[model samples]
Every structure is written in C-alpha cells, then in structure tokens.
Target: MPPHIRIYDVTQNISSMLPVYPGDPGFSREVLKSLEWGDPYTLSALHLSAHAGTHIDAPSHFIRGGRSVHEIPIERLIMMVDLIDSGTVVSPENLSGLNPLAEGVIFRTGSLTGYLSEGAARACVDRRLKLIGTDALSVDSSEEDAVHRLLLSNDMLILEGLYLEGVPAGVHTLLCMPLKIEGAEASPVRAILAPAEWHQWIL
Candidate 1:
C-alpha cells in the first residue's frame, strides 16, 4: 500500500509570553473570562512584535523605500518548495540536488541558528534560486551583510527563523502565510509542507 498523506508543519510555536528582539515586546496573552471563571466564554488579548519568531521580512525590513508586508502581493505567500538539507554551509553544488520547480527555497543547515558565509550564498545563487528561506536568524554573513544585499537586491523574499528539523527534501507544496499587518516591515508566519498532489498542483 502507498504511504498515507502527511502534513509537515514548518512553523514555530507561538509564545504568549516569550523573548523578542532587542527593545521589542514579546507576545503576551490575557484571558478576560472563561467558563471556569463563571463567565459566558473565554476572551483574550495579545501583544507581540510584528517581526517576531518564524517571520517573513518584507523588502522594507532593510530598504527604507520598499513595500511593506501588507503591500506585497499575496501570490508570493504560496509556492512549490524544496527543503534543501545543506548539512552545514550550503555549498554551490548542493543547488543541483534541488528540484528546479522550487522557486521558493527553504534551506536547512542541520542545527545552524545564525547567518551564512559569503561562499555559501554565492554557491546558492549560482544554482538560480530566486526566493530564499532559512531555518536560522538570517541567511547571510552578519559581519559584512554582503549575502543579505546580494539576495535581497535580486528581489528575493527572505523567510527567517524557521524550525525545519525533520522535513524531507523533495518536491512539496508550501503555504507560508504571514500576518496582514499594514506598514509593518515583516510578520510571523505559519509555514507548512504537504504533498504536491494533496494541493492538486504539480511541483
């Protein structure tokens, strides 16, 4: 028999109260009432950074004269995927292992939680990846910020702070939907992976 349908959630856990960026407030939730409190139902309130955990950074994140997250076209939120397991620094040659249809690329560097080296970025681009996503804080070298500029200048959409440990590398349907926060540079997203056939679209 064939394998049962599988859905891989590629997103991070939402913390009602957790650490956030420097000088930025993390998420906080307060329940006003509940059945246990003898009220009709439960109600809650929340506060969090627009660019907190597992977020998508819009062009405006760095470029002052760029489009905000809301201004971005919704079409960019969904695309065919390739979860490339580079295993460390993504080599230029690793790109060849990727399916060309994965215009939306989410790379995994095993346990990497920081930026990338210039060499890695160069290798990635040599393979013609358009959009870039990573399970780290950023996808480029932090010292010079060269890799960041290289990819962003080419109109790449950067998905930062993903948690992709067990996902397999292959053709999959990706649905990464960020919050619709107007004028915000970025927002957290709920990312997921599923079989292409389940989405009724070929990868």
Candidate 2:
C-alpha cells in the first residue's frame, strides 16, 4: 500500500496584521453587508496590494515588457522543489552546491524579514531555476530591489512571505496557485507543500 501523505500550507494569513513592505499597501477589508445587520447576506470588499501576504512576483514586476501574473504557465507553479535551510544570509557561496536537477527552490531563512544577496540571485539565474520561494517578506532587502530585478528579468517566478515555520528542508512538491490577474505584475498565492514521496502522484 502507498504511504499516507501529508500536505503543509506555507502561505501567510492575509489579514490587516500581516506585514507589508515599507511602501507597499497593507491588506484591508470593508464589510458591505452583514447578516447580523439584517442584510440577509454577508458581503465584503477587499483591498490589497498585488504583492500582499504570500504572493508570487511575475516578470513584469521589474521588467518593462515582461510577462505578467496571468501569463505564467501553470505547470511552472507546481513542481518538485528543493528546500534549503539557508540561514539568514543567502550569498552565492551558500547556494554553491545546489541541485542542478531542481526546477524549484524554496529557502528557509529563519526570518520573517530578510533578503537574498545580489550574488545569490545571480547564482539562481545561472542555475536556470523555474521558481524561487522564500520565508522572507521580500527577496530583496529594504535597501535595494536588485534580487527581484535579476530573477524576474530572467523570467523566473518568485514566491515571497511564506510561513515555513516547521517545514523540513529537502525534496518536496510545491503547489503554488496565484490569482489570474490580467496585466498585474504580481498576485497573492496559496502555497502548499507535500513530501517528495507524493510528487509522482501529484504531478
């Protein structure tokens, strides 16, 4: 018999308390109707930045004529991933022995706020990765946005603000589904992970 598989949600909860980049808009919801108010139904209006909460950054985020969120191929979002415990600093040397066979890579940096060094971003580009996910709020530090530019300009997708608290580092299957927002540079995603043993069945 096949082994019982478990799925893990690696996405951040989308709420007003969720952290946002310095200048980015925060999440908010306005209730238009409430059952308690005798409106007969519950309705809400949500306002949030495209990159709010756990999100995916498309090429258009930094490239002038690059593909937008809706243009990303679905197959690329869901694939076998290599999870690495990259500590707090993600330098090129930190990624020196990356698996060439890995199509997707997720970095567990042990911080809700951190960034990937420029050289590390270049390393990822050189490796020709399809997608990169991180537990950090943003891939680039508050000082600069070079990492996002390098990765997105190369047509590589980025997933940020992941809640990877207890997830193990190793081979796993990533299931990231971003909103199909036309012409948008980024979109929030529901990121999930499952053991590598479930990869064959999922794909």
Candidate 3:
C-alpha cells in the first residue's frame, strides 16, 4: 500500500446534466418503476456511450480484428507508470525528461483538445512506452497525432480524455480498469492513483 495519494474524482459527469458531444446521445435517467406514495422501491436506468466519459479506447477502436475491451491482456494495462506534467505539447528536443521510456506514461496536458504530435509520439513509442494516458480529450490529429497511432499500433493502451489534476508527477500505483464489454471498441473507465510508497513493504 502506497502512502495514500488522495485520489480525486476526475471523471466527468455522467448524468443528464452532463454535456455531450454534438450528435452524441445525451445522458438520460428514467424511473422504470417508482417508489413514492405507494411503491416500495424505485428502479432507475441510464443511457450513455461507453466512450462518453473518461474512457479507454481498446485496440478494436482502430485496427480491425483488434482485441475488444474484454479480450485485452492485463500486462499492458497494469504496468508501472511515469507521469509527465509537460504544460502542453513540447518541442521535438525537449522530451529528454522522459528519457528511458520503457514504462507506461501519463501526460498531464490539462485540456481535452486531443492532439497527437508525431515527433513526441515517436520518441515515446519508438522507445517502447507500454501505455499512454493523457488528460487531453484526444491523442491524435492535433499537431501530428500519428504518435498516438504509432503507440497503439504496437498493442499499447491509449488512455485519453482523463482529468488528472493534483495528481503528483511521480511513480504511483494505478488501478485503471475499463468496463468489460464483449467485442466493444472501447469502454468508460474509473482511473485512480495511490501514492508510490513501495519502499514501505520492502523494509
């Protein structure tokens, strides 16, 4: 157990009050049965997209015949992670801080614009970063989103649309799990971080 790194709820609202993408289905709440004056219990239902909130896009999201959310191996999703608080995009040369990019990475971009600069992408991917998570909305099509694609092409997990504010920049325990939908392209997830106090157990 790491030193309780106080994980905040960074996920977006998934209720009727949430703002949906244009043309996407608006969140809905309905009482299938009411528990009011006479009824005993109330059953409420919801309608939303798997990619509606902070979510994980499975390989099926891009390459055809890729594994669905349920089919992905756990090795990629649960590896060690290194977080970077690089204000926004960086020049091709400034990525030295992320040297030795063998572990997974979480970029703290602070926005959901969803761009993917090719140079930065190549550096991480070429060095075999196992997974990539971004606070941005998308990791492709911004400057040269092909970087995201390059990582994804190697069976890497691409986590986007995350809102990781206040989460410190260091090694932390990531309990990131996606919804299990058979054969679905992606699924919404609940990502949490606990401080890295692995030293505690080592003693």
Candidate 4:
C-alpha cells in the first residue's frame, strides 16, 4: 500500500437501487435468516446478473469460446489507468495524445451521456489497451454488439456501471477485481483508484 496515496471508490453500490441495462435482471436480496426471526446469525441471499452494478465483462461475453471471468489474469485487473472525461460520446478524437502505454483507460462521461462509439472502441483496440472502463451502463448502448466484439476480440476487458461523478480526469492506479466465477461470462467488481504510484504495490 502507498501510505501517501488517497483511494477513491469508483464502484457503484450493489443494491436494489443500482441501475442495470434494460432487460437485464436488477439486484435483489432475500433475507434467508434474520436476527428478528430469532436466528443465531443473519444471512441473506443475493440475486443479480453477473453484469450488474460495477462489473467486468469477460471476452466470453461476446465472443464464442473466449476467456471467462476466472480465466482473466489478476494482473490485468489492476493496472496503470488513464481516466478521461469524454462528455457524451467517447470518440477517436477524444483519445488523441493520451499515453498509449496505459494498461487501462476509464471514461467518466456522466451516466446519461457516457458511451463509446464503435470508432472509439476500435481506436482503443488499435492502442492495444488491456482494459476499458466507463461510468455508463454499457460501452455502446446503440451498437453494443459491434463495440463489444471489437474490443473483446482483442482480449480487452470491459468494465461498466462505475460511479465516477466526482473523479477527475488523469492517470491513476486502478484496482478492480471481479468475482472468480468459473466459466462465467462476467462478474461484479469493487473498483477503486489511487495515485499512480500505487501501481507498484498492486501485485
């Protein structure tokens, strides 16, 4: 851990209130055992889509026979990231002049307006980025299949439903780890950011 670095929680809280993509299952919790029921301990059952809340999409989400959530390397989840505020649509032009060496890139394009055009997704693939994250529910709401294929085909992980409301645009160290669900196409994650120097301590 880097003692001098401040950590920022970029993940959305998982709950019934957390928004999900249209047609996807929303989060729900069932109280299996509660203190009020005279149980020794309280226990709950969580039900939600693998893609719900702050989650990561594995290549298998779009591509057939691609890597699953558990197959993704842990090193790839924690990376040196470049966070950009691309307004509504993240275009190829928005990525110009950014550090190509960053393993991950996060876009803070506000909830309603954030999404990547297919062209922008291609640009990221061209840059050989390992991972891409956004505050939006999906990278491309309109052309989701195309955009997802383009990026996932390149083995790039897609992180969605982040909470970047007050996060500034800059280079930071990203620490995002999805559930290690074997053969699962996607998994929710607890994403956070810290000073870039923290990258060295991630392993």
Among the numbered candidates, top lDDT falls to 4
Q: Compared with the true structure, what per-residue lDDT tens digits does model 3 show for residues 31-100?
A: 7878784668888887887777677887777777777899877655555566777656633443567635
Q: What lDDT would each prediction earn against the true structure?
A: 0.72, 0.87, 0.67, 0.88
Q: What lDDT tens digits, residue by residue, belong to model 1 across residues 106-134?
A: 77876434556667666656656656788
Local distance difference test, candidate 4: 0.88
What's each prediction's clash count?
Answer: 0, 0, 5, 0
lDDT of 2 by residue, 1-203 (tens): 98677789998899999999888988999999999899989999999999998999999999999999999888888788888889887888767667666788888888867779899899888888988889988898877888998999899999999998888777888999999999999999999998775667766
Which structure is stronger by lDDT: 1 or 2? Answer: 2
| C-alpha RMSD of each candidate structure in angstroms | 3.0, 1.4, 3.6, 1.9
Off by over 4 Å in 3: 1-5, 8-10, 17-23, 90-94, 99-102, 142-148, 197-203
> For model 2, what is the C-alpha lDDT against the true structure?
0.87
Model 3 worst lDDT window (10 residues): 194-203
Which stretches of candidate 4 lie above 4 Å from their native place?
Answer: 1-4
Error of 2 at 92 (Å): 1.6
Better of 2 and 4 by lDDT: 4
TM-score (C-alpha) between model 4 and the true structure: 0.95
